[model samples]
Target: MRPIQNGITDAEVVFTNPQLNQWVAPMNGNSRIRKREGTNQNAGGCRLAVDSAGHKLDHIIFQGGEDVAVSEGKHVIDVTNGYLYGNMMLGRMGLEADEGFCDNVADYGTLSTYAVNTTDIKLLYYWRALYTGINRANLLLRSIDNPDVSISQLERNHVKGQALFLRGYFYFLLVNKFGGVPLLLTPSQSSSNDAMQQPRATTKEIYVQVLSDMEQAAGLVKDIRSVESAGRVNKSAVYGVLARVCLYMAGYPLKDVTKYADAASWAKKVIDLNYHKLASSYRQVFINYAQDLYNAEESILEVEFYGNGTGVYNTTGGAVGIVSGIRYFNTAGSYGYSSGFVRPTQWLYDLYETGDLRRDWAIPPYRYVGEVITN
Candidate 1:
């Protein structure tokens, strides 16, 4: 067994094909890579490159699929155990229990259906890969040195700084999901020798560490050439992540409440940084319908995952569902779908503001798959 690095221990490491990191999911076996350079559209376009000074990243993880040929194309093949869920981001598949799909609901976002199921092995894979990045971050922060390779002093500092930022990043992920896990700052042994099933730390402690890491990352990448080429980490990315972490910490985890102000501040950083911006259209953020590779301005520090790489997957089935509007399907004045799983909830329908584009397209008659449904 390998030693535990970061708060992650030996038992935590599931040694599979390293390729799994690229694409592992319902569509894993056939995933491919689409490499592209990061660019700056905010200014005269410039390429952001992480010079050799910082430690070399595994580069495998960040190489997530960027090609329409790789991601949107149909050639993707499933290689990992067929979990059938897209490892990419959230989606709106179907809820067999607890929650039911509503006709009035927008086209996507169904993760809450399976959100309560702690038994999801796929969830574990997602978390483990996330922590692996943390482990790498820890190792690099200590030093990017390998007896087999040589490097200049300046490059070493650059790499170390990026590691510090990433270490903070991984911890933030763990804390968000688990609600305060042990702060694993250093490498660990198989026994977790000094740290055995360590108790969950306070959310405050995690927040402190996350803040520290972001600040450190900000300083390290301050002078890097371009936003896209800064390798895996950067200043604006840290700020955006910091804003999100602060939002969670200040809210549900710690009840500090004041953090929202800071959250607002951090969010403002990316908005004002001249680096990133919200896309005019919300849907494009998920699917790469555009030709430009880096949705750089809209996406700050996106986790790279190819369509069907080892441990890599996407949201196709998740994307499949019935979407209707008031203009389309309606019996009298109700909403429903041709689909069995998709039925609208009163709350979802009521939540809409008047004149919203989606409301006019409502599917109605309140019909379930096998029976005539009612509001």
Candidate 2:
């Protein structure tokens, strides 16, 4: 008989630590898989990870999820069959045989079909994940708000700031990806699906809401002198992401050029804080960290992932991973996920003018991955 003293679940009991109730509700809520057709299916969010195979299909099939196709019919689309057609495969048309995926237009020429992949759940995943963190922080703030708990005003404010910033961060992430997402706050204390699946909000409206929440968060955390401020949503992190939101607004469908000054100002604030810098050795930012992620420096803010040790998701993606050779062909000795599958385009490789250094480090070509280039 496990303790359910505060309505904590049995599984929670197993996961609880004597030192910390790490797996309990709010701070750590329940996310057991609900059986589907005798098999369990986790929802598409934090507890639910985006499937890469799905993205691979999305990249290959559709006209382009967040990108466009360069070649005409009977190319990779026709060659791969209509399997390489339709957003049903996750904007299957999104694949271009190059890096930065949709970052450029030149790589649009000779994209051969690689296996299915997925990463763009990005907006939904970050929103869901960080909001989960916010919920945890909120639960702590609210429950500990009694005479019994006696949390100090500053302590309360700290958690409140964390929660508020996380909420802001989550919303910013969502609006970027899905265009607009239903904002969900106030953790449900009740066991119900009653609150899920709310209608979407407008991009302008969500952007406004995000700004409002961030203002509250920025005001709440007065000084940024602590460990939490460094890693998590400290004032600087908030400003950094705020810049991103503004930049995105200016660039894409929004095309609000007026937002540029705000973006530049936010970037300036990050510089003013002296919290981080544009690493002296660019490779050091990614290289040292790939060996042991804790050693990484460039990541001003990052969601830490533990080695599931299941050998799943066991590939370096953003900087190190290769997609083409490994994820699709299951090519042996691939260094990283990006190393395995995603290819760096010749055009991108051309961006460097003689000795810029960035172009070489980034578009280093799949042929350079150690001694594995057998062809």
Candidate 3:
């Protein structure tokens, strides 16, 4: 796993592969990496190279393919997986059933005060899930100087931008949910007591880090659609997320009114990019999604899902559709299992303007219609 000490010289790591075939082969397996630095770009740009520190960035990037490629491309493969895992954690946190037909016994218990009991183990589980994402991103950043894996400055910048975005995003979630939290910059490579006993940082400090990371990422990432894989984060998504983060920082607990202008500025940048536009028909978006067709032009960022006939919880499986999909019975063309746990409040349904397409699209006429009906 450690590339620099494996009796491999930096020059051998970078230029020894005359054909540069070793690097391209592993990168080609990962769509995003292939697109970023594939053979087509410079006849073999994906070849791994080392930095001045005798570290091999290529070795770090190669650590993650399916069966694992040569020593060089393994690490790059798992980076995408880390982002996917973080998305799932975000999805889980927003699953509180109080929103409407969804009913979770635990949600009911916690809704009254908008608080969780300290004794509730689920809180710890959720916290750890988010931190796991943070740790993965941190480790990637930590290894940027591994003289064993050879990577160019451009490649390093792109990877660092992504790592920062993910780390900031995880911290944003932590601060919003639990207030002040320990701000661990270095990766916890071991389970030593020193790693576990860090003190909490103020919410302001966390917000500063979040803004700093997002701001840097916005400048470093390329627009995603131009690349082969839209699944990965891009400059536009970074701006969009920055807008939302600014909004969060501006509201309620933080009350940093000045950030209102910052939020607006970031959002305007996304709009100015014109990379995505509103779909003419909202329902078409979901229809396309169910059919495994994604509209990158209209959806700047999307969390992808693959549905099986039966619902299962796994990295590749998504239950949000089932959790919030039409409950009680299945709809022939629907994307979910109709778990019937979450429902919309009638007040919310009625609040929409009569001609607004989203109102009905959001809360359909049929409240529950599969072998059962409840008022």
Candidate 4:
């Protein structure tokens, strides 16, 4: 299968009609191409196009979806460059400060100082990442059902289910952050279409769509045990996310008290699955993240990062431990380097009771000094 040359351009030009021979120009200002007339020629054309487009669907789900979900990569500028770090890191920083657990350093004081606004570059990055994921999912869903494409019914359901879940999850993130956003469910065939400029859907309407997509996906997707990796969405992950969504609906903004029962019901479904359980220790959860180990029993879903910042796979390294771990500057030492941009506050320290194992691990009382820990 051929790789996608341009994501948006390729997605817009995918045609399934077997009767028209119209010339089409991609939205990216690429050279126009003419489709030859005849049924056989159109079928051959669809097969060729579907092969390349199918590869693109897989690439976006695995690579682009991961970047949007976890916010990895080195270039902290453009979201398409695999530098969607603002999504998770910025949210974490803001939440830590808001919850009175930590304070951001002056050097990285955007969220902590309440300087963030609609025009913030970080917000723009995250917005672009989420929409890009949605667009990719839309393209996949629209193209997967072509009669010329060779795929089994079971495989088609699996792929379609994943696309629906990703689209719903992206919408869920957008609604939580921006309250309301334009909902574009279908693939955009042209930039000139008037329908492309959709008005923002209501908060409750967006949640309803999210619930529908996820509920349908829960039935179509593979079970947690059937999936090969925890990174891929499974029945358990959908159920857990459904629970979270219901709880959100039950809180401020929507404040739909009826959703509380739904949230409990979804949570119970996850528990009744008998597939997942809490880890032996809370510290072990973070340890597994730092070591790139998969604890499927505990982590229902995860964003996967691979390799160090070197060679062809350099861009796959994550900043999980480096940005938030204990302060350290020795590159050759076992502790490695940490910026320690956010530090725990005294209020957070005093909140923890005696003999709390999580207190020391979450808010470390020590620092790394030349390969040694010092209190």
RMSD (Cα, Å) for all candidates, in order, is 12.2, 16.0, 9.7, 11.2
Better of 2 and 4 by TM-score: 4
* Best-matching candidate per TM-score: 4
Candidate 2: tens digits of C-alpha lDDT, residues 1-375: 000011111111111122222313221121211111222222221110111232121111122221111111110000001111101112213335343343322332232343323443422333344344334434333432344323345544544565566656656655665677666565433211322367777888778777777767666553444533233345676677778878878887778999999999988987887656565687765464444423212445543211111232333221112233223323343343333333445676676798786764555543543444555
lDDT tens readout by residue for model 1, 1-375: 000001111001111334322221111111122321122111111111112213332311111222110111111112112122222222223332233453422322334344446565555555555554554445334334443223334443445555676678767766766667667775432212223366767878887998998787677664322435212356676787788888887776488788889999888877777766676655444334223244555656543322211111111112122222112222222221223335556566677697565443342444333345689
TM-score of model number 4:
0.72
TM-score of each: 0.54, 0.57, 0.70, 0.72
User: In model 4, which runs have C-alpha deviations exceeding 4 angstroms?
Assistant: 1-87, 100-107, 189-197, 290-292, 307-316, 331-336, 372-375
Those runs of model 2 whose alpha carbons end farther than 4 Å from true positions after fitting are 1-148, 189-196, 222-225, 228-230, 290-298, 315-339, 366-375
Residues 316-366 of candidate 4 have per-residue lDDT tens digits of 233444446677655554444555556666777888899998998888888
Error of 1 at 167 (Å): 2.2
lDDT of 3 by residue, 184-211 (tens): 8875532123334788899999999999
Candidate 3 global TM-score: 0.70
Error of 2 at 156 (Å): 2.0
Candidate 4, RMSD to the unseen true structure = 11.2
Comparing 2 with 3 on lDDT, the higher-scoring candidate is: 3
Descending-lDDT candidate ranking: 4, 3, 1, 2
Local lDDT at 55 for model 3: 23
